[model samples]
Target: MLAGHAASGQAPGTGPGAAPPTTVAAIQQLDRVEVAGRHYDNAVGSTDAASQGTIRAELLKSRPALRPGEVLEFVPGVIVTQHSGDGKANQYFLRGFNLDHGTDFATFVNGLPVNLPTHGHGQGYSDLNFLIPELVDRIEYRKGPYFAQTGDFSAAGSADILYRTTLDEPLAALTLGQRKYQRLVGAGSSELGQGLKLLGAVELLHNDGPWTVPEQLRKANAVLTLSDGSRAEGWSTSLMAYDATWTSTDQIPQRAIEAGFDRFGSLDPTDGGNTRRSSLSGEWHRRTDTGATKVAAYAIDYRLRLFSNFTYALERPATGDQFSQQDERTVFGLGASHAVDHTLGGLPARSEVGLQLRHDRIRVGLFDTQARQTIGTTRDDKVRQTLLGVYGQTAVELAPWLRGIVGLRADQARFKVNSLADSANSGASSDHLLSPKLSLILGPWDKTEWFVNAGRGFHSNDARGTTATVDPKTGDPVDKVAGLVAARGMELGMRTEWFTGLQSSLALWKLDVDSELVYVGDAGATEANRPSTRRGVEWNNRYVPRPWLLVDADLAWTRARFADASPAGNRIPNAVDRVASVAVTARELGPWSACIQWRYLGSGALIEDNSVRSSSSLTTNLRLGRRLTPKAELTLDVFNLFDRRVNDIEYFYESQLPGEAAPVADKHVHPAEPRTIRLMLQLGF
Candidate 1:
């Protein structure tokens, strides 16, 4: 059968009610042109509501990112920033949720989960420094909890980054910037045999950054893939490896900066981190006249060692409060899915069933450190976490202008912890959750659709939190927290493409969680307590008025708070109130192209009482390029074009300095990078 027919069973210009194919091989003579072009478009036209969108390769190429992980900023309402070294994971914010190290937002690349559970630094810690943006084909993102294909760490949203299977041509690029920044990348794909292809890519980078301590970041990344067959029937295997190390300049107290300290100065120069990740993954797929089936599996080896000093002299006046968080782990997972077209009450309907399983074996520890040397141990444990999930979803065309989707998902998680700190804390815990999802889509009137979506979702707590018996610091008794926290979400949204070359979407969403997962920086663990709620409105627009010009805009406003009344007040700390972005791109403008983008992050509460708030920040970036030849180009990128002096991140907490008699509440801030320019040269063969 033609790849498109086997994959989707839809013909050109077909609507949602297209008929199923009669024979698998009937259209085999037809090439897979449609399938190739619709790969990313399918994500946009899928049965999901307006809260979902896709970023294609064209958009990725048009935007210039200060950091590799900033590619995720393409997702509406997402803000990507870094408070530490460039080699570390970027901090993430979405929909009023401070998703510290990716606690509530799931991220996937080429079917491999990027979020790590039961990590030493925090729960669901995700690091995207390994990703090579040039190798990505598209990013599919969904907000809220309305998708059955999503599970843990998906309460707020999820993004699946798909890499390119093959490159049209070989590519080599080199970049140089201020402050000793340098990078080199090479990627290409080649045909091996009939229906077989090979792809490979490598990236290396080093940067001192604009820091008083000199970040001295060094990173290397590589990916290799082998594949055969068409989208209708294909098999692929891939291997990826990444390693990085850097000296971090952690957030500094605003008081110190005001006291004549440099904004980029470091309190503890030894603060830094080292991380490595290697993985092997494979996938198989088959398409029949009735449906399609896919299976995927992956195995990963990961390690991390981070040293941070947040409280300075709060705990140890002479030795400082510096500590180390370490995690070494192996992860294995498998997923299988099958989709079929069927009749529901004699109505055109589609059904999909999927099963997912994952297991993690981890050795995690926390230790007090002075000058990056361990002084004493706090907690050390070996944890094994396993999860199994099953889900089924159905979509039926209820009428010519209406469609309904219903889905149910069940997940079971088991955790076993072997604590070296205290035998009393070694234990096993298990939890199961059942979530139901529903979505209603109405109308295509004038190329517009309205949707209503509601669903339940959850995130797994840190294994240590599930079985802890005592505070490692004070030896005081402590209660164990739930192994899993649940969340519920609802959204009313609309999508419109009535205007030619323009697509727009608006969504009003609300989410409530049974408890918030707070990262205890000093303790090096996640604490689950205090129920929370968030409500927000988002509007996104993309306009392509001409073949060479594109304009895009997105805006979000949110309110987040603690569900229960408290003496400290109900405001959720670090929950941003507003976010806005605008971008304009001119591509292939007669060998000259340009792009300008502006991003805004509004002020937010720094503490529960909301007595102190962070200052809003706005920054702009510009990119100009000139095509030297059909296969060669040069580009210049100017980041923080206006040289806005602002804080990248802010936190309100208690800290004690060298001469202080007691701890005092103050604001800790990481200043944003100043204006800098980078030039890049690219060659294609």
Candidate 2:
């Protein structure tokens, strides 16, 4: 092509008429290179900031963790917690924040939001533990609100999980290794063909991992998928199942508390929980010259259980007694989404029209096991909300090298809270939101592509993690607490490929969110009407210099601050100041591969209050693998290789407190894991 380089720089694959390597001359003849992912096996190669894949021949050749969460590590603004590597309670953080551990990311499996309608405080109780490693053929992340039909994603983002179809022939694999630092998993798939597919995988993960806590993790996962031909056809149906059971432990250090990294130093590893999820969905579509018409329906169920004793007995200055106690929460949800749409993209213009409806309900209860009474006397509550929306988007090819996309949507929700024990406290309210988006991509150079995007999106009220307590007198909690309403954000980004197989993406974003609920420090609880701002940047890069080796890196930095005065005075907890990672992968021998990953994390804010925070930290992971065949592989991995001293509590002396702040600063940092390693072997037939 242009010179001595490959035309499109795409890795080798088995497909019809693939593009030449990514050199100037080759690209001129072949417009774009296709990569493997959920939507299309032959879509253009992505230099996008939040897009990546493991299905690429090169990436798949090396044996690695089979879960989508593990692969997403290469993306910016994303950090995953294996719950001590157990896999069942797997967790993640985005935009320097966690959505109540698993609740916020709004994970999806095949265009379906994995969140359950009944999850407590919107905490994620979806089915991340459902799929066996083999069931997920590939995974994808659609960051921000760039696409149509998808709006109301607060600060973090959304993820799309794609299941691998069963092949015509039978396949089998076994990944036997340590969980946490060492564990094992086995998987297989079969194709009945003629409009049928099946995939399945199961794993046993154990980790006596990298934290100071007496770490131990165990969980099992399985996923099954049955789908008709592509949606382009007339009709299709899909079935899915997800499940996982796990328990984890944490031990925080007392000194790290003084450093401002956490609220408490340690958590008894004996504290543990179990979780599960299941779902089903179907779609029907008809294609035409002008646009494609489609209708779809989906439903999901999820559950979670937690049992732990709060052991950090920090003496409250006024009470002289720590609020130490045993706690448990049981939550469930039911929901369905129905939408009809006209898709427009193949012509000189792009457009989509659709309407969506969703209903969600959550029930929550907590009891102080030690005291033999519910923590607040009236601990049971029920909240239900319904969302209806009409959305549309269009893209026009302005010129040869430029294109633009414009989109708009309107949404409304009505929420009602009911509790038999506190009927008088029940209340009902309605809210509406409008969203608009604009995006433009420019191609000045064949290999250099740039994009600028701006959008305004909002949503009605919802609470996360923190819930209201009883009034102590009427057995009723505050009704209008923190109504999540009308949040807005803007996203700007760019992506490009450079010399020597390097690809990079940069994004800058800002968010302003307002909630009707407010927090009160004096009462050690919250009420209603609060606002905050989330602003940050995400930087990511990938380098595949040779056919058998690659390197990936990502950095996420944010400054999420209170936009209005709160009982804590413009302060919020759990938002980290910074996070970064670097990973290197190697495949020098046929059937052999190795990898190493490094992480750097700045201090994190406190969990329920802003007075304390987590500490700065750094850790590393190393792995080795050998491929026995195309469908089989083996590997060994070590987590927290250094056994670096980790601290979960960060305390500030009254000396460091800003004027008029709490004098004794004590924050809790959750310990990660201790150094550990695992060996694994997997096979496919």
Candidate 3:
């Protein structure tokens, strides 16, 4: 089966049998090593924290993902769900925080950043619809703010998804499912003369979900990559393009459900979105026995048109409170890093320095809409933003049984805004920040190691918020907010492989943020929130009881609250407290393979006062694959296998029905899909 886990081998910190000094070149070399028959890759010695690891392609290929964004679920504590149409960005929850369209989490594909700093939808908005899972080579993830290579939107964690330069065999696949779902994909690679290789993939998909209005989701995506040489010395260039459009079935109020509304019903059939993106990226790296150097650059063009009506008639009784958001942007970025191996005070050591630069030109607008037609404009603005970050890090063997890592980073941001509707809101601002990080590793006694880490990190806020002085929609006086928010984090963790065929890790961590201020693009205003604090514990285990069977389980719990006192109480709304997942896979059982997975998301407070709460949910998925011939195979996938009646997402807000005299407070929810099945036929040459 495609579902498997690897914990990597254990190595000492500073003894005669200790692992090599950690460096960019060494890590790249490690990644090049083949793991053809291995179920998991060893991370015990190569990782600085127990929470850091890599998921290989062998495992990613076998997992059943209902949506493209669900690929991130393999990261362990992360949960991905959608509240609207399939074309919209997926909502993410991790480490007790509702990420809200990818805030506080940094994501990179082929070294190109995915999070947009000043977006029309929200701050740090990220969309991964363009990704082709079949082309991914591996996913490298690090939790917390402990790594120097990461910068903005990394206060929570970061992930780097690397694509393969070549495919083992060419593939063509077709998938069909219930609700008129259809997909066609083709991928292949060719070796050019003189060590050059070209890889390409294309996908076309359509789905009309189990909704009364019919989603009518249409999408097209493609990727092309060209490369020469290997990890020791190589250069590669890639091009990606994606376009999508869909109708929406947004969340409905509980009152509507009680009034004979279908679970897969729509509040506003006109609510939907269309988006397009294209990018060109290049990367080059050279590695030697003593050092390594790498450089990357990218340019992107993006556009989005979205319409949504969340509160119904709460704000505009005459128009039904519908609004539209539009964004168009061009982005350019460059990054370079160098690492050297040397001796510090007669001890083995490695040092690295890096620089990152990015610039964005954006045109964003908001409008009042009715039935997909614009009525009046709320605000329109042209924004120019630039970001720069520089960092240095060093690792030294302090003792035969101890190792230390230290780093420092500096960041600066500048924003210029030209408000088209209100001249008073046009202005320019700049901000800078300094952060420090430290980590210590001790002993591999009895195949176990302990780690302590502390660091400071940050996320950039929307550029418009740094200059606006009045509410765009209400014309009320407002205060400009900071351009960047800071966060501090610390973790104590351990990893052990004392028992044969079993790997385990445990971590205790805490984090504090200076503020939770965010710019609401939908409302055309800034909402300042109080400071917040959070603490959590996690345990992850992988065991292979037999050569044919693999079992993996992960559990996490967190406590989240506002740092300041208030009459409304300190509970941080939507901060889920518990999450768990279990998976079992059986492989090499003749020509048949099978996998089963269970996921749970615990309830959380819905409001600050804790007077209301959301419900928990549990769901299971199943997959079966059979080999039909040497070059052909068939597979079946089942989603929500038990047909549980649950919600994908929930919110508490005020809205008014068609005949209501006053707005009413109630819970709004997007129900999870019922049991569905899909079948696929794959051919390889």
Candidate 4:
């Protein structure tokens, strides 16, 4: 499965430019490492209270990758699953919390939520497979909720991805690389005409044949943006379009091979799925005489078809039969924000408010025939979500060195699900949510800052529009769910750059989530649980010793607990117990620069019937590249320098009942190509 997720949130701190370190401790600390006002800076010390290092651009480029999974070794408290020739997919955990779908850590893009809001019957899905690494301009991560103004998931903090804007110098970049085990990658981007910018990339990647299994990857993407710097009297208007295709069919270990596991299987490279997504968005900003107001509207069309050919099953034989599944989704959304600068309580303050509306449609088709035949069991559903939100915040100096910001964001969102069958639609329900936030920045000395924040937030229950299965045999899928989920509490702290070039932050938090989402009992049964709590801590920091050389590190630890669940009770699942990374790079060696990166993940734990068990593991990857010319470049990449197996997946099979009956299987980590090297060159002029 090829998927991706975005890490984003509003960049921290109110300061927008370089200013002399004031007497404010918190403000100074935040400002030192956050010299980013361009793209999106996630490592802005203001967000992570527990951060021990920073992940700035120089630090990032030293071991740059186009997606979060590729940069796994750089961030602590996270684990990555890599196929010999496939893309990186992460299983997230911060502090000790368990992430959804193995990949925790919520994602965002330009402040736009990407976690698929699904039917209330199941947990929301995050599609992190579409993240294109080359398009990113900057990445900022905060370990704990130390200096953050706002964040999602009461426990785990947030990471922001800042894409390059349509700024000067007519941006352009192309990457061409090869893996000893994988095929190749050819990606490029350029500016089109005036008022418009364009970017496109494609990968035909593959892995080694002599290795245990054969893996391959193919994908393409395009993006176009037109900007009018006139936001209706000092505002800006932008018209944008995005399209992409992704498919991955790598090595599939056989059932017997996975048990204790026999290690015998020939490579079958053509298997995974094919996916396409298209979206168009319009954004307009008005800086009229009456403050500034911004509005955006968007429409998205997404479709995916997966040809899952069974190669491995617990007790089941490798079914020659394949399940060709297809999913279609359409969504529409609108958001508007208005900021006003004024004086209240004899202090200068700013207030901003916004709103969002989204309509989603989903269709899942299960085709039962082989020979590439199609017989659709259409199960279609639609959901309308309306979110109403308003916030009021003000920052004032209680003294020359102390500043505080308090704000309340009230949000009411309702989800109405309607099934294709009228009888099954009664399960449709609605949920509303409101959250409050507050924070403070204290600068007690020059070039440094200290911050603390607290807030209340919540995630609503999903209504998938299908009725519950009343009968075990003819299970019913039905009525929409109602009422919002339980509210959560959060806290944060941060300190950064009292001087220049170095910054850090640390945070600890806990979240009590109500109506947990999960899959229970049968093969296709999905349901929501009673209550659960997620708690963890994160640390991030950055250090720049020279203009061309940079170094950085990060760590996140999480603990997610399922609480009061009837079918299952008080359990903590295994996600990486701890994740950490270190990167070093210098790009000024006359077009020849070297970057080295190291990643470490402690162990994951199994939460069942109360007690916990751990799976200890670790892995690392490295790469070296040279810029051949202005438009062409070459890179030599190596994965698993020491060839360490770290992934473990335990499962029970029930179908292959025979004299050769083996009920369960353990999937060992089969990532990284053998010790191989390749060079790629790309050019576009």
Candidate 5:
């Protein structure tokens, strides 16, 4: 759930129960309709900042995504890549931050939060494997902490994905690709009478990746929803279930690959994971002339069993350094908000207030393992974590050309952890924080607008870390960490549609964190680090030169460093400095459509010191589609269109080989999938 107008202003999809209108061209009752896209979606006056906008479903469908998480790449400056198996959470990078497993970023589907707190693998572990892209209607996104509606894990940014309540037609699709990749999906919506509609979707997939050990991945996912009315006056309930299992090929040391090992080979073939998630959620919305109200509630059941071998034999030469992480949890959440439109001193104004609550009952553990068998327990804990946030904001038209938005948020967190193995490490604690936000919007002159936004935000540390007193592996005293860390950010931006058939924006932003403390879930401890600062500039553009052609380009550059003095150099590890993307799409070209895109990931420091740096990578993807009949279509997708040799992720760390006398420091890399092809036939009934 999001904050009120006072906290974040009148952002898209933030007004009381109101969703942003389609930004692209509207549908026509002709033989064919031109699909909507960001290029056509105008945001000049509707958005509070240049960095915030809606990505339409048409744009999502036009792109070729190798994984579910890659969908987030649609957000400018964000990169999504996998370091391990398909079943695991994808690594994310944004705004000069290596948002490991969803840290400092918030994501929501419909109204259910996707980022899990106190997770076994990592804090705020967000797994989007259950997402069905075709079912998404639109995605509303915002960056920084200038919004009250978003509370935690949002210091960098947040995205809220909305699902369509109904479909234009029923769909059935089958896809087959290289490396034994196969998939089947079916989705449809039906009228249930009396303003009630039912939507259902299901997906089944299998793939054996291009690894020597074979990444035997399998998945089953489904979603069902019942809804009545529209966003301004409606209610909906949904049920979702997803399950996945896969054998993974983790990153291999450069020395091993140079020593005659296959680049795609795995040092530990047994490394893999299994995960399942099921949830029930409901939402209600009502709107009138002067006021509106909305409420959302959800319950979720989730479980995960993951085995990884990152350090090889560095610690346990006898049996290798393999380990297992197990997590099982039940989560409950509720949110409610109300907004009123009024007049202030003869000026038009709007105010809103909201409350959000979430609780997680979790059982999590870390263990030493051989193959997939647990040999020893590092730590086992039962955690109960609760979060409560209340926020309010107001938007006012101070003058003919000036508008202002201000808000405040209060958050309270309670962490209760019971260390099953070490009572000395268990404790209960609570913390609270207050955040304030402000935004100023000036002008719509010449189809352009200027914006200034500033805010304070916070992210919660792991509950275990907030209460731990001793390290589980080493019998040493440990210092507890703050339950909450604060962050401050500001942005100066501009959005314009001054050029015909084009929408472009530019933003200059800066963010500072009080501390870079983090919980090391793999070892069940906290890593206290230094304060940091990040600054960046982003430029995004979209153009439709013709009714059937769309072109888009976006570029971002960031400078990140530790704020405190350190001999290890001030550079932040894995803080990407540059990113760029270009895309061209042609649709309705006489029953044929095509799209091509190029993405670039610039080099960055691999460690605190800048001596070791990663290499930049560029990749291209292409999609071609044709209509077979009024009800049938065919499509072909090529990933890594140029067959580029590149790595998906890279890290510098210490590890030991089976016969090595001692440990060695080297670069570990997971190679990106080579050129691959997929073909699909879709039928509408």
Candidate 6:
């Protein structure tokens, strides 16, 4: 059975040992409310505007995602796009923040953190290629920094993905698409004696994109799980493994493409990557009449070798500017939370406490390369990072129509680095931070509620940046950066279900960061420094007029800028100004079903001066399906329905070409894939 409240607006199940309702009508009564089983609810009178609400499994199954990570696009006001090969992490944009490789946004799967601190590629690097979309049961997302349970990399928002413990029936699927794409997947679950269950899944995939140099991507993934009991009181253990290798087609200079060069051509064919990950995780939960307790632990072994040549021949003209970033690490973490219900001043109340601890031992390096062969090392370091966090929160019902939540959190992080390039740069650093949070919820009058929220959050800097005393390229002294960057946010919002079969929400939010500063260890330099501010508004609507049809629309607009004046101007580079999406889906319509969606990403400044900007991109997709038999189905997906010509990503930078006299500043972009189609066959037993 699935967890969470029923979509039909029925009351949730009572806790263990509770008396069952006498009649079906009593079970469906809206007035008979139960304590929220999960953190948030999506019923008519539940949820605030800052919450996307719980995305049910049925909805996830109805939507068609081109990439596994694109499933997150269901979160309102978020956009996912890719600039390189499919094996790499997708670029993310939300609430006016670029969120490069998930710097400020946090993501999790089954209580396991996805962001990697002190990473080789970028800070808080997040890769989601290991996710198996078909096994996902629910997605709960929250925006802003208003929750105590969220810690690092959650200043922008956070998402928790849950997978089903057991499948109703075994499944097998095969997909074939344009550009030589192929995939095979199988999953199943079996019940053991005395409430024990076993589940397993495996996937294989390959793809060669439309680039002149084929991507030649090959990926393999597997998962195994064991569980017992219900979600409210249960324990589960899981093991996962993933491996992939691919040839990349990096972004190209617009000048070259306009000068008769093939748009799909690559300047360096050796630019690609290989990565692997294996992990074991376990989660346990216990619930009583008045409270609940939960615990989780995980360990991961990961490695990556990435080759990139973004600048052509700019830095090492002789070596063609190609470089390699290697990372090998082991991560371990533990988390526990306890919640109890009580009375405060004769009013209903709840108190919760949580602790989180994580440690990473890593060997990371950056080296100049030619034809995938290392020429000279820029920096190589062995780093150890440890983080500990504890938090407490209380929720009180001040009045029949009012509720308030107050929280406090403290976090400490320690970093130790051993630099191989320069002994002088090796050192240790530590930092601590405190955050306060508050949220006020107003009446559910006429099926609507208003909310006000404010909070503080943070993200940790790379360990190498925090301990460095000198530059690796030049032996010049350099000041160490702060180990943690702080962020503050406030929001006012409302959620309403005043209309029949319709739900709508709106939020006005603002966020400020102390500084947008980062150390680029790969380049042996530091990024530009500037404090930044962002304000945005989002509107989301969902309508289900009929049992078989659903419609959704989300729109957002933002204004972002630097807080201090500078010669380069005040605009924040790559901070998107607007985004919109609309989707319509129909299912179980006499053996025929269909879905169509449209997404738009507005243009933004590509440089600090705002002198150059990227063009907006719009794409439409359609999915059609037919029920061949009771246990079999076929689906056809058409991507880029209109064959739109657009860019997946754009940047403004200086580069030197083979025949250029000096370096030239120009726009570089990765063109979006054109029209394509995929066919899939699914079988269930």
Q: Rate the local accuracy (lDDT) of all candidates.
A: 0.83, 0.49, 0.82, 0.46, 0.85, 0.81
The TM-score obtained by model 3 is 0.95
Candidate 1 per-residue lDDT over residues 220-316, each given as its tens digit: 9999999888766788889999999999999988889889999999999999999999999888877766677777888999999999998899999
lDDT of 3 at 232: 70
Which candidate leads in TM-score?
Answer: 5
TM per prediction: 0.94, 0.76, 0.95, 0.77, 0.96, 0.94
Residues 1-685, candidate 2: write the lDDT tens digits.
Answer: 1112211111111111111221111132323322222112222233222332223324433434434455445445566654332433455666755544344455555545655432432333444555444444344454554444554443355554545544444544433434334435555555566866555555555444333453454555455555555534444345554444434443333444555634222243344555555556655554433344556566655555544433333322222211222112222222222222223354255455666666766564443332222334223457676767776666555555565667787777666766544555456766677778666656536556566666555433343212334552345555444333455666676655544466666778776766523222112234453677788888876666675666767887888777875565564566777888887888656877898888776777664355566667788888888777786666777767897766422433222122223334333235555565556665555
Candidate 1 lDDT (Cα, 0 to 1): 0.83
Q: What is the lDDT of residue 5 in candidate 1?
A: 27
RMSD of each: 4.7, 7.6, 4.8, 6.6, 3.9, 4.6
CA error at residue 215 for candidate 5, angstroms: 1.2
> How far in Å is the alpha carbon of 359 misplaced in model 4?
1.4
Candidate 4, 1-685: lDDT as tens digits: 0001112123221101101111111222334343333212333323313332323444444564534454433444554443322332334445565445322244444334444544211233444455545445555454433322332332344444444443323323433333333333334445555545444444333333333333344545455544444324322222323333333333344444445432324333333455566666655555533355556666778775655433333312443344455557787766665555555587544455555556666664344324234433333445555545455555455554556666666656665555553334435444455566656656555544455666565444444422433322245543234444544546555554544766555666666655555432122234544566667776766566665655656666666666565555466555445677766666668878877666675655454443445445554556677887776667665555576654423222233223345543333333333334445454545
Model 1, residue 75: C-alpha shift (Å): 0.6
Which window of ten consecutive residues has the lowest lDDT sum in model 5? 22-31
lDDT tens readout by residue for model 5, 645-681: 9988999988898899988999999899999999999
Model 1 worst lDDT run, 10 consecutive residues: 9-18
> For candidate 6, lDDT tens digit of each residue in 1-685?
0112322111111111111111011111133111122212455434433453667667777767888888788888889888888888888999998888889988887657888888878888889899998888777777888777788998998777777779999999999999999999999999998999999999999999889999999999999989898855888889999999999999989999989999889999999999999999887777665666777788999998989888898887777998888899999998877766777898777677878899999999999999899999988999999999988887777776777778898999999999988888789999999999888877677767788989999999999888787778787888788888999999998877677767778899999999897766458555648999999999988777776777888999999999999998999989999999998988789999999999999999998888999999999989999999999999999988999999888989998888788899999999888888999999999
Question: Candidate 6 versus the native: TM-score?
Answer: 0.94
Name the regions of candidate 1 deviating beyond 4 angstroms: 1-47, 519-521, 525-528
What residue pairs are clashing in model 6?
none
